[model samples]
Target: MEERVKIIEERSLSEGWFNLKEVIYDYTWFNGRVQRQSREVAKKGNYAGILLYNKEKRTVILTRQFRMPSYLNDTSDGFIVEACAGMLDDDAPEECAKREALEETGFKVKNIEKAFEAYTSPGTLSELAHLYVGAYEDDMKVSKGGGADEDEDIEVLEISFTQALEMIKTGEIKDAKTIMLLQYAQINELLN
Candidate 1:
């Protein structure tokens, strides 16, 4: 793999919420041709996302919050309904998922099952998303979870699983991770 690609240079473009770097690399094609390319990449730590569903009630817990990028991309108000997720700081992926569930949806989820891992945006983002599904009950709600960060203003939503699936068709749910998790549940019959 190292022989396939060589890093020519790398420079930092910005560093805040995440580090952005401009990279120049030399890549050898399968036919043995070499080409130099440059690209800017956002380097964020891996994240853990969890879809909380209640099997008995056929409901899911989600969060709605304003996303600046979505707003810039032409969403009416930038508010996106998504599963509970967050970057894995120092915690293990499972711990991070549970923490995010508590912080974003006020559900102390237990017995989460790992679904799969995926890259959020392979071309631009260097983040591997660790996705999971967990069962939740009303008694697990300890607080009005609206995120621990000061900049976060999240609204917790407990909507029917059927309604969530409908939102995907209606384009009301546009977040990739959320959609993927929901589809996974449907395919795996987690709510049935």
Candidate 2:
């Protein structure tokens, strides 16, 4: 497939917060036809997310925060329940996951198991997300974590696993990474 895709040109469209680039490329179809196409891609760097679970309590720690994109797209309040996550930004995926977990939920997660890495939106956005499941105990909470900075008005919630799963059915908990991790825990019987 590498031989089938030839990038003819690339131009930077924007470079604030994230990068946007317009790329012109030639693709050779399976039927031996060459097609030229142009596409604009949003380049947000890779990220890491971790689901924190307390087995003894049968609970999961999640965060709720206002997301402008969700609000702009029809989420009534724009708040989403999600796992702790952040950009990798010069840190290893595991380290980034741990950091985000602590910063967002105040849990110093120690036993983290890597689940998988995925492209959140491969069609137009360049973001690869590393997913993990982390175990925590009551003693792990070191602070009242609502995010590190004032701008991040995050609310941490500790809810039973069953309740969280029900939220999925009730049209809540719509964050993709959070849903994936929750389903992974259920399928793997991690809390059991």
Q: List the lowest-lDDT window of 10 residues for candidate 2.
A: 68-77
Best by lDDT: 1
Name the top TM-score candidate: 1
Q: lDDT values of the candidates?
A: 0.95, 0.93
Q: Residue-wise lDDT of candidate 2 within 47-150, one digit each (tens)?
A: 99999998899999999999988999865589999999999989999999999998999999887999999887799899999999998999999988899877
For model 2, what is the error of residue 52's alpha carbon versus the real structure, in angstroms, after optimal superposition? 0.3
The per-prediction CA RMSD against the true structure, in angstroms, equals 1.1, 1.2
Candidate 1: which pairs clash? none
Task: Report clash pairs, candidate 2.
Answer: none
Which ranges of candidate 1 are over 4 A from the true structure? none
- Can you give the TM-score per candidate against the true fold? 0.97, 0.96
